[model samples]
Target: ISSHVHYSGTREDRSSRVVETIEFTTDRGQTVRANPVVSDTGTVDRSGMSVTVLHDRDRPERFIAPQNGHGISARVPVMRIGFGLLFLVVIGIIVNGGRMILGQLPFF
Candidate 1:
């Protein structure tokens, strides 16, 4: 496991510290590498940080953890057939009922 710490001071003399790099062993007995970064926010005592992960089989890029703790893999197309079938069923019902009821009403 390897790690690095850095300190950066802004022009206003306010200092900020950031820690990066993490190495650990996975359940499969494989080595994993990651870099965690911390940055200062506009508010005092508040900062944002993220980790960049490097995978053996995938591309290396920075990834921010989801706010809700749920990670998304990829995007999928929205299924339209279900909605289309629902719309057709409603239209068929409305048309059939309209004809039956209108036929009994006197048009004059």
Candidate 2:
């Protein structure tokens, strides 16, 4: 299994941090993409870029791209969980959204 990283460009995330959009080819020959907001390495332009990444054994899409001996902040996963909870709550509300809004009985 071989792995590699490709740096496309940078974008300012909501946190005002400049993040690099990278795509990596997994050992399974599947390409996974990630945006790492913090990198210890100076920077890599389109000219060429490379970095090492460790992925989940069961889910390759979840990975970490460490730069210059530093890994990205761990709070990211916490945020993902929060968003997932919010999504579920929204779906629950929508299940009987009309009833809830109209103050109807037997809200599902």
- The reply for model 1, stretches above 4 Å from the true place, is 1-78
lDDT string, candidate 1, 31-99, tens digits:
655542322211222123333333333323343222223443232223466677889999999999999
Best by lDDT: 2
User: Which 10 consecutive positions of candidate 1 have the poorest summed lDDT?
Assistant: 38-47
RMSD per candidate (Å) reads: 13.6, 11.0
**Model 2 agreement with the true structure over 1-108: per-residue lDDT tens digits:** 122344454565322222556678888888887654344333333324677776775787676666543566556678999999999999888977876667865553
Superposition-based RMSD of candidate 2 using all C-alpha atoms, in angstroms: 11.0
